[model samples]
Target: METVFIVAAVIIALLLLSLVLVKQGHIGVVTRFGKYHRMMSPGIHFKFPFIDNVFNKISIQHRSIELEFEAISLDQASVNFKSLILFSAKNSDEDTIKKIAFRFIDEKSFMQTLIRSIEGSIRAFVATKRQSEILVLRQEIVDAVKDHLEDSLNHWGFHLLDLQINDISFDEAIMRSMSQVVSSNNMKAAAENEAQAQYLIKTRAAEAEARSIRVKAEAERDALELKGVGNALFREQVATGLAKAGTIMDAGAVDPALMLYTQWLDTMKNVAAHSHGNILSFDGSNDGFDKTFKQMQLINKSLLEKNTH
Candidate 1:
């Protein structure tokens, strides 16, 4: 019975000694004989009672570090720049985090060094580029720095997620000058655009007006040509009719006195049929047409009688 109780107690102590609680989002590295044996993931884990040792525990979490400082340009101008760096440990094991904890400084130290290096690089970049280019290529400079830092720090078991410039402060005078230049450029572009729009509108309006005038002139010319053709046709018809009448008269098929007497009888018949009352007609200033007719008849009768005798 005593031997069984001692055996049970020893088993309980060994079990207790072999058990280890690893938290969530963490990994534990076990080492044996001062060398890496295996890595244990989160939750309860077991190890040999005396042979295995827990070396280090590491977190698998992404982290961020912010840094801000001033840098001087090649032109002796002070620039205030602030940046944020996102980084994470590539390995999250007991041994790796332990090594990192002892061999590597904290995030703040790393961020300071990173910011200093980035500032130096930006300075060199700005020296080669104009101030305008610097402003335009600020993102490029940031990316370059991030790439360089990631490459350098990857060996140190760290991965750079990103590095970005939050703000860049310039000298007041330089800022004002830049603002003025931008304002002037915008104003010039606006004026040029306005001028171009005005020119296009005027050109279109002039073209439309010219087309309208041309159409009106063409219509007037066509109307005048039509009118001239009509007038020429009427004059030709009148001339042709007059020529035919003259030819008929010259042919002597009908006497001139007979034509005059026919026309006079037709005129007197039309006037009598349409008259409202009796009309006393006169020949020019003669008192009556009857008296004029009597005179004409007497002259005709005398001529006729002379011919007969």
Candidate 2:
């Protein structure tokens, strides 16, 4: 009865060692006599007792890590980058799981290679760009790193899911200098605009002033022409009246000298009526009046003869 109990105990221990449980999101690699044999899926998996062993359990889930590093730009400026990287196993195929299991000595070594590859790719890209271009090339940098790392990671049975650049920054002095450059450019644009505006204003003012002068000169010329025309018309009317008066006097068989004397008297009366502070010194004697009237008569006789001719 004691021998039977020993055999049963050994069987139970063998059974316990043969059964393996693999949790969700994980894959178990089985090895026979320390040599790779097959892969075990999640849940209860039976293997040869004391001959097959659970070699390595690899998680197929996505994993993330934060990275902070510095890169030197082509312009010899230091750029700091903060980023997050997501990675996972390529697939669940047996060959893929085998590659992942045997790619590196351990998870730590695989992670080191991955991190170094990412850093190398980033540094190489950054070395070719200027400091001013680094801030806006976050997506490009991520793309370049993925492109450079895709084949390498695939060889190790891994895939790059995502890469995020959280922050990019330059040195304090460089930042201040960049700000000054932008401010100066804005100021230059403002100055150019102000100069153009002033030029337009002055040009318009000069044009307006010239137009005003031209208009005033035109108005004065028109006024002078109208006044001259009015004066000419008045003189013509007076000449006609005098000629008619002379003709009437001659028909009546009256002396034209009598009409001349009456006109001289009328002129003196008008001068006296309209005089403001003007002095009129004229001869009041009949002899002086007769002399002046004779001169006027001579002038009128000559004008009438010329008109008749």
Candidate 3:
């Protein structure tokens, strides 16, 4: 029984020593005779007991790291910038990742190296550019970093996913000055707009006044012309009426005295028709209406006899 137990223990120990397991999304590097033999995928894997070794395990998964750096502007002004970088192993080559992993003990040291490279490149980029250029083309800087990192780190099995610039802080004085200048420019523009508005309003008012004066003058001129036309027409009508009256007189062949007496008699008849029984005081020598009527009839009859002769 003692010999069987010892044999069982030896078998178990040999089984444990020869077996290797790799999880999902992971690959194992198997070394034989102290040299790379082949790669093992996720599952139970076998290796020579003492000659073959599981050198490294590499994961084909996404990873990210944050990076920060300081930059100096064109005016020798310093600025602080921070960003995040997301990367993943595109190639599942365990040898390549193992080489990279061996250079740096862990993910943090590898990230530190990447951060230093990024910072150096970004600072160089910013140092060559002016503050205005940096402010205008920040996206261009990010693109450049992404392109460079993707190209440089690809051999290390890292595929760059994205680079994000989170925050940027400029020198206090420069920031304050930019703010002041922006505010002043806005105020100047506002004042210019107000002045232009006032000028337009005044100009429109002047034009309106000028138009009003012209209209008033035109109306006055039209009224005077109309009055002159009316006066001429009135004079012409009066002259025409007088000429018609003269024609009637000539047709009748009557003396002026008889015509006047006929008109007076017509007026008296009209007055009598309107006055029903009203008493009318007369200016006479107490002889009354009979005396006045007899005189008028005598005068009218004499004028008529002269016309007949």
What number of clashing residue pairs does each candidate have, in the order they appear? Answer: 2, 0, 0
Give Cα distance to truth, residue 215, candidate 2, Å.
Answer: 15
Whole-model lDDT, model 2: 0.90
Candidate 1 TM-score, C-alpha based? 0.64
* 28-51 per-residue lDDT for model 2 (tens digits): 999899889999888899999878
Better of 2 and 3 by TM-score: 3
The predicted structure with the larger lDDT, 2 or 3, is: 2
Q: Give residue 176's error in model 1 in angstroms.
A: 2.1
lDDT top scorer: 2
Supply candidate 2's per-residue lDDT for 201.
100
Reference-based TM-score, model 3: 0.66
Q: List the residue pairs that clash in candidate 1.
A: 56-94, 57-94
TM-score of each: 0.64, 0.60, 0.66
lDDT of 3 by residue, 196-285 (tens): 999999999999999999999999999999999999999899656644654587689854444444656777778878987776555556
Colliding residue pairs in candidate 2: none
Off by over 4 Å in 1: 1-20, 29-39, 46-56, 91-102, 105-120, 244-309
